[model samples]
Target: MKSSLTTIAKHPSISLLKSCTTMKELKQIHAQLVVKGILNHPHLQGQFVATIALHNPTNLNYANQILHHQCHHPTLFTLNSMIRAYSKSTTPHKSFHFYSKILHFNNLSPDHYTFNFLVRTCAQLHVHVTGVSVHCALIKHGFEHDPHVQTGLIFMYAELGCLNSCHGVFEGVVEPDLVSRTAMLHAYAKCGDIEFARKMFDEMPQRDFIAWNAMITGYAQCGRSRDALSMFHLMQMAGVKINEVSMVLVLTACTHLGALDQGRWAHAYVERYKLRMTVTLGTALIDMYAKCGSIDKAMEVFWGMKEKNVYTWSSAIGGLAMNGLGEESLDLFNSMKQDGVKPNEVTFISVLKGCSVVGLVEEGRKHFHSMRTLYGIDPQLEHYGLMVDMYGRAARLEEALIFINSMPIKPHVGAWSALLHACRMHKNKELGELALEKIVELEDKNDGAYVLLSNIYADYMNWEKVSSLRQTMKAKGVKKLPGCSVIEVDGEVHEFFVGDKSHPRYDEIELKLEEIFRCLRLSGYVANTSPVLFDIEEEEKEDALGKHSEKVAVAFGLITLKGVPIRVVMNLRICWDCHNVAKMISKIYDTEIIIRDRSRFHHFKKGDCSCKGYW
Candidate 1:
């Protein structure tokens, strides 16, 4: 090794360094270089330090030791190598310490890479104080105009929530390139300024895939799912190919919109393009199909994957739970643990929900306790809400109230609603009133609470209180959310509001609905008009119950759909009358009727409901 060091000059030394894959091999070659005085070569030393520090990060300490003990004075290249490595190091504070050494010992000024790495580190750490100092130093060195340095500055300031400074740095650039513009787009999205992100995306001369995905994701992140889907269509029309990132964003939008057709199209694109399947894309696809009523397909994709992460299991489990397959969801969760995948918060959300759906009170209680005691995760509001709902649905009203009172965090509206609605179900007027009082204290204008209370009053023949509550609701302008249902027919969604005879085919729809009503009566089915909380005439009440949005959508589906199941998405909980009607219609038409309401999924088939009167 010593004889060979003399023949190995700088260029051959690089070749040796490239060939040396392990730290042990590099150390042996480095020892020979030191013995032959090769360590004094500036370029050779930089190459050696970079190999250990940058390429192989775990050996950064060894690289730092070599830089500290080097016999020759540190050159800019050598200093930058150490600084660059430390920038990405877990201990990024060490990068600043090395920079201080460069300034004090070698009198070498920091280069562009030094600032770039430090600024990114600051962004990662969210250390706004250090980021500001780095920005000041860049300005002092007159490198603020450097495209790469300015890009880092933009990212740092954006992450730090210093949008004004971020924009100032961006606008201050002489002529920003693609990297710079893309950073700005990501920054704007992070800052919750989707409008600004779209502006930047539109103004950019050359739109890359990153830019396209950033804009689409920005819209989705801001709850503008429609805009995100529209942007995706425009991207495809522009001949920009869709990748995994883009597909995930588009699927999210489709999930929010319940656009089953669009989701199917995205899945087809993935298969056609042979895109590499990642956990994120797989999870997104699973969630999309699950929300779109394609649980079978979601599971098919789930089982075909070779790799599974926590999110993968969570999506599959949650998808099953959402589709009213509670037992299957819990089974999949057990499978996840058997496969050595740890459950996350989202995983338990589905687990608890499955327990609630299937009335597994003991299992739900055990897992709820395990959340904190076993996994060391505190139960969040959503978890508590699910528990309250689980107990309420199980007719354990006392336990539900106890759970609400014992909540570490203040109970949300959904939790109270679950308890109050349960009170109504069990005819527990006292607890129902108590839950409504707390709800009113939390939010004064909650109309749902008033409606639930009125129903409770009406149930027990307390007409005086019901009337009083109705007057109060009118005085406070508490309007009930009008019930609406959407059914997708031939790739287009048709919506029907309660008592809405405004559809173009309203004549045909009404005629079919009447025919079905006659058939339902002939089957010895009676309309349960008990859900009409309002104190109206019996005939008017029956007519209103008959014209519910879901009933109309079902009638529409029977007339339009040939053999496929009728799937309806509703904006509110299914009323008792509507639920009964759906079961009867499913039997009468001899077809499956699936309705997803605000609370849970109801699959009516052959005069039986998946909810089993539990919902």
Candidate 2:
């Protein structure tokens, strides 16, 4: 029977004989081939090899063993199948080495699919040199013109941050396809060139869902939030069906722009499309509400979700921290731990911020230590800055300085600024000067640092140093960022600058502010004009403080909104005098005022800020 099987397997019709559609039929044929002992024959062996490799049958390892012992040298198709299997397998490198063996020993010419498998492995491993070597091999063998090969090459070069190389490869192809164009767009976006990405996207003649998603994600990631939303609108107008990823990007852009109306539209679109339940989309929704100053809405979205992950928890935690529900945020952190979801670095940062806001020094210290001992996550620079800010605000200047020295990474301007502010708070002029020196060394153009340092020197009557610092700033062309604040009243965002009269209603705002001051004075609010220049007359100092950006914002809130609490969001820290006035305004008007300053939310009601006057 074995001799007869060998003869029939070599009969040349064996390739046609083994072409069975179903695995059951294939196995029956295999049984017949075994009865005749033709499975070991070379010509018949290739048939078994091609069939099993492509069929995805059970007992594939056994089939592989049979082919390995029989052929000693496999055919091109046989090698290609094995290559693909290995490419899809966990051990791609081993499959790649096998293909090399096929090429070296039997001179088996690899096809398009073979190189595809090999290059994909290089991409997965992020082995740029290996990928380039494979590209050279393809060029040497004259297969570079294959579109599939070009696509793979584009992806490899892009991932390597070699956008120029990716463009070079794409240009070599005559009329590149959608996949290659999308790859170039992704390359540009990943390399932080959003303009070039948009150009590449525009040049493409045709686009699929993947291409659109790539471009949208690129825009979203490159801080082109408005552009991303505009593109989404255009895609919708073009009748392109929105996918989960597209929704995610646009929702994130809404979050960044603080576009509450657009965010609501996105939320409605998600419900309309029945995508509200998707984890990615749900997380984006939560983030959108949180960032749009609607923490209650964010919580609603969070609680509505049936599934949640670290990002979901982080978004809610960070949102609550931002909204000044510090106690609630900390409670959620505890709940997250109780649910067995390990806190990541970002989660810890949010909770730390909550601690900083509420002055939970002991809890903050415990979490800081637990970062490494419990979670095994080392604190990064931002975390360090937060800790320094925390300790500094708690009036632990020495401990703050000690922590600065103990940081694993060199202190950046942000960390130094934290300590500098702490020094000013505690009147540590010497340490403030030292921190300023480090800050200038790290970031010479830091206007805030210069201003803070100058103020510290002035506090101690170091007029000469202040003059020198001012002259240096003028020489270096370092312009200070003008203080600004935004107050939303009656569905309009009113922006104000320190001592600015740019608004068309500037006169009305001024008159109303004067009235507010008179009312405050009548209610026992005294102006602390020390933060303003003493060189100015006493009345002028009062006038300047009244025209400070935050004061204008609060004044507008009081005059424009009727019978409601006002929320004022400022981009800078509230000065001591301004904070005092806010407390007084809230008390006299009998209205709540929520001020989100540079650091945290200060909810003022009846002559009290959430910080307890410590910040």
Candidate 3:
């Protein structure tokens, strides 16, 4: 018996099975094992099961059949292998079937590996009760203190949004190792407790790439783009090996800040390190370039990619729309269909947005109906809002109102807000007032509605109504969101707020602004201060408009960054006055000025805007 075991262990079939690259090779080895009558041996059976179940192109059903039918006395290792494989598979619930088998086997018992995989399966399932039951099973099986098991529990609870449970599991460890500590940090970060995550990160004796990534991704996901970029800078200074994950996170930060220079550096770094341009990384590059006001580069990246997914197509399409190339966006949507990529809900949003920007009312309606008829995708609230915006922007207020009243679902704030914006653009005070009334009824604290209505009133020189709305806002404690703009120079982001004077070079920036306005005035630029809600003198309104956040950031850019385009990212929509000023500045200075506002990108060059006043 011992000699037969030794022969089976050293069999040529076993060696071939270990290195087999394809299912055919594996089956050939399996046939040889059966031909030698060594397949019935428990050790050989376990090895065969492991190889088949754990292979990259795994045959779990076949391995399961062999284990249950061929191996009469399967070992715990064989059962655990099945459990671990199924844990990562799409059918994670199948892992519980093998766990039950382990419990049924009188001679075999589950160990740390079984529980670790089981905990991960629970996380994948995202069932809180099942995760708790698994935790109890881990304790009953005497693996509650195992570091790997504990780490899995932390992750499981984090996925279930049970932050306290994760903390409890971490605190129960006698002396947590690096893996457990990192898991806790990830839990905090994943649960949106970034402050605690950062504190824990700082207190750690050592930090790895995973910990750094968790922190940076947490910041990015939470809309703390500045902090995300700052952390990326620190990660570089610490000599941590940058990977594709790091690049993607930093690119997201750059996208939010419109930090084109930093985004360019990240793209160059990926090339310098020869990192494989994965579909996700390629998509991020396209999005960053698009949002940073570089549509041509975005297109270049989109075309250069060898592999493209639906998300990649959507990003490219959305980038074109955001850059105010609505016709090009619609053209690409057709190309996407030709490439056999079915559009999802997000794809339709971009399509409708493209229609809205270019006033393609007929095309927007055709695509909007196609979403349901062709793709079986129901129009969501955002789609409805876009339809309203399309008609509203085209000055078809009656059609927009008809569409809003026809919505199957209750109209949301976005629909009314779109109508209000259109009213403000066309100076339709009656419709603007009606939209504001509906918006206020839906959301009394919507500062944007109040601000928009005030602007519409100010447009008609209705000072009493504007002052009344302001008083109502003050009474209701609805404060307008202050405008903020960010610009990057020398790879560092500079943020400016409305009337901001905190920058060290504020005096220099002020002087530069004076010079810029002088040049702009010489070229027939005038401040259109009708949008200002304050009932102040014309000179005071002009001064207030001049102190807007984007102008300050642009002034700083002119003073510090010469021979490069001035890129500004605003937290709100660019006013008419600022937009005109940017166009004149671009031509007078013979430079480009790109501003990404709340809605879309405005590329100012040679006294013209890419949006052509559409946005």
Candidate 4:
């Protein structure tokens, strides 16, 4: 609108931008520049575009107005600004439409920065075929060699799980920066190839925090929890400052190992440094504490969070269910719904688990049926298993059979395994055999199925069938998985097996166990030897029951650690004898003992278990 643009020629760009603290101030300055006949000045216009696109923290609509409405003939800087804004925005359609403007309205060819922004937008949208077209545009414009552009392309392809294409783009980089190489590392890890990811990681001459985080998280995704913890320690020892991201991954490792002590240390580190507790890091802490036998602490972290995403609610709710707080878990689910958090399949899975723990048959049935009707979430195999387990645990084998037959999908191995466990609990050979038959029909003949069937027969005094099942297992080369338990003490994990006597303080632990046994006998702790049901003497049966892996792990914890909670991770379900003994140990020692067995969690406090003998 100005006739001669010279009134604002004395103003410096830096000071002018420094004056804009709000969008109103910025708009006023723009109007003054235009009325003063300096708005079209190249340097001032470029600064305005940059300020609108990158600097203006309040609103981005000003950029669009300046380029589309104010300037009939906008410069290259103006187009790039608008494009960059749209690229970072969540809704990217406007960004692409603006990119099309360059070909239609503007005669200016797209520069490397322009295409770089477009590539980043494509990555954010995760539109693969469209991204490939954008890549073709970059090639057509001869900006393919641009490092930032190629890096964007690499990330887009990597996110699409297209590792082969990532390899081509990565190999083409004449000199790769840390971002590009980390993208490649993450790409390999995404495909579950830890070895190749490590090879690429080791080849890097310099690794940043992002690079190290990629390695730790890759190991976790691959189910290498021990290796992930090892890498985190190495990263710390190498003098790389750990961030919240690394802390989350390490906490996840602790969750896998049931390493309560290590998880506590990570929590302390977060507090000591006053690092920002992002949603991800907070969710990880909740999960870690919950799995580590500290459900109260998990709840503490959960309630303290100002923001709760689906992951946060799901982990906290699921933790309660797994720890045998069925009623509390259900209540929290209701709260999550009232908070407007949509219940996904994972959330329903936790809800179903809570229903199973509390024997809420009618509630479970209603929710399972409503999964597709109300939530549009089709019931997966795990849901079927939960229903079956619920019925079976409630001593309703007939309903379990009916549910399995009604499943839209096939009742896979997990579902049948749940039914088998229920039959074992009720000592029902008829239904146990039926479930075992279905289990054998599946592709993976879970050895646990054979063992469960055998245990069921042993409980019913059908020794002949038990012997026959074990013979068949040997003929098929199926072996029962050895039961093992691990306990963490002072940042070190000690593993114990059934009848383990290999600890360095074996004599001392044995002596302590004897003393505890004497005290247990005085307190009328009658060992129920029904689980060791073999053609053995009473003495041998009692001995076998006493030497269970869970008991050994607890004894080790009591011997080494003092006055703190004892947490143990077991590879097999705790037998009834060990469960009873654990309750007595809790009451006798005046200490809490938490055990995570193959099935679910048992938090024993003052002779009372969280499961309440339901599991």
| Candidate number achieving the greatest TM-score relative to the actual structure | 3
Among all windows of 10 consecutive residues in model 2, the one with the lowest summed lDDT is 54-63
lDDT of 2 by residue, 1-615 (tens): 787667675654455445556666666767777777666565566667666765553435645776667567666667777766665554556567657766887566777877877777666667778778888888887888999888888887877778888888998989777777888889899888988888888888988778888888888888677678888888998888788888888889876655566778888887888864688888999998876667899999998888888899988998898777778899999988988788999998899988877778889999999999998899999899989988988888889889999988998888899999988777888889899889989988888787777777767777677778888888887877777777655434467888788888888888988888888889887876655533567788788888889888888878887777676666678877799999988888888877767776677889898778755
Candidate 1 residue pairs in clash (backbone atoms < 3 Å): none
In candidate 1, clashing pairs total 0
lDDT of 3 by residue, 1-615 (tens): 999789878877777787888778887888887787778788888888888888852588888787777787778888888888888886899999989988898988889999999998999999989999999988988998898899999999999999999999999999977788889988998898999999999999988898898889989988999999999989999999889999999999999999999999999999999987999999999999999999999999999999898899889888888888889999999999999888999999999988888999999999999999999999999999999999999999999999999999999999999999989888899999999999999999999899888888777777898889988988899987899999999999999989769999999988988899888888787788866777689889888899999999999988888999899999999988899999888888888999999999898999999888766
* Candidate number with the higher lDDT (2 or 3): 3
How big is the positional error of residue 60 in model 2, measured in Å on the Cα after superposition?
20
* TM-score between model 2 and native: 0.72
Whole-model Cα lDDT per candidate? 0.84, 0.79, 0.90, 0.85
**Candidate 3 vs. true structure, TM-score:** 0.83
lDDT of 4 by residue, 1-615 (tens): 253334343475436776677777777787777786667776577668777777743356777777766676666677777778877775665777677777766467788988888877887887789888988988998998988887877887877778888899999999988899998999899877889999999999899999999999899988788799899999999999888999999999999889998999999999999888999999999999998888999999999999998899999989998988888998999999999888889999999998899899998898888889988988889989999999998889898989899888978998888989999888888988988998998944478888778788777767788778867877788866778888999998788887768888778777877887888999998877766635578788887887888888898899878998999999888888899999999999999999999778998999999888867
In terms of lDDT, the poorest run of 10 residues in model 1 is 2-11
TM-score of 4: 0.77
Q: Tell me the deviation in Å of residue 117 in model 2.
A: 7.7
lDDT of 2 at 63: 57
After superposition, the stretches of candidate 1 with alpha carbons farther than 4 Å from their true spots are: 1-146, 149-166, 182-202, 495-511, 521-538, 542-547
For model 2, state the Cα shift of residue 205 in Å.
3.4
Spell out the clash pairs found in candidate 2.
Answer: none
Q: Is candidate 1 or candidate 3 better by TM-score?
A: 3
Each model's TM-score?
0.79, 0.72, 0.83, 0.77
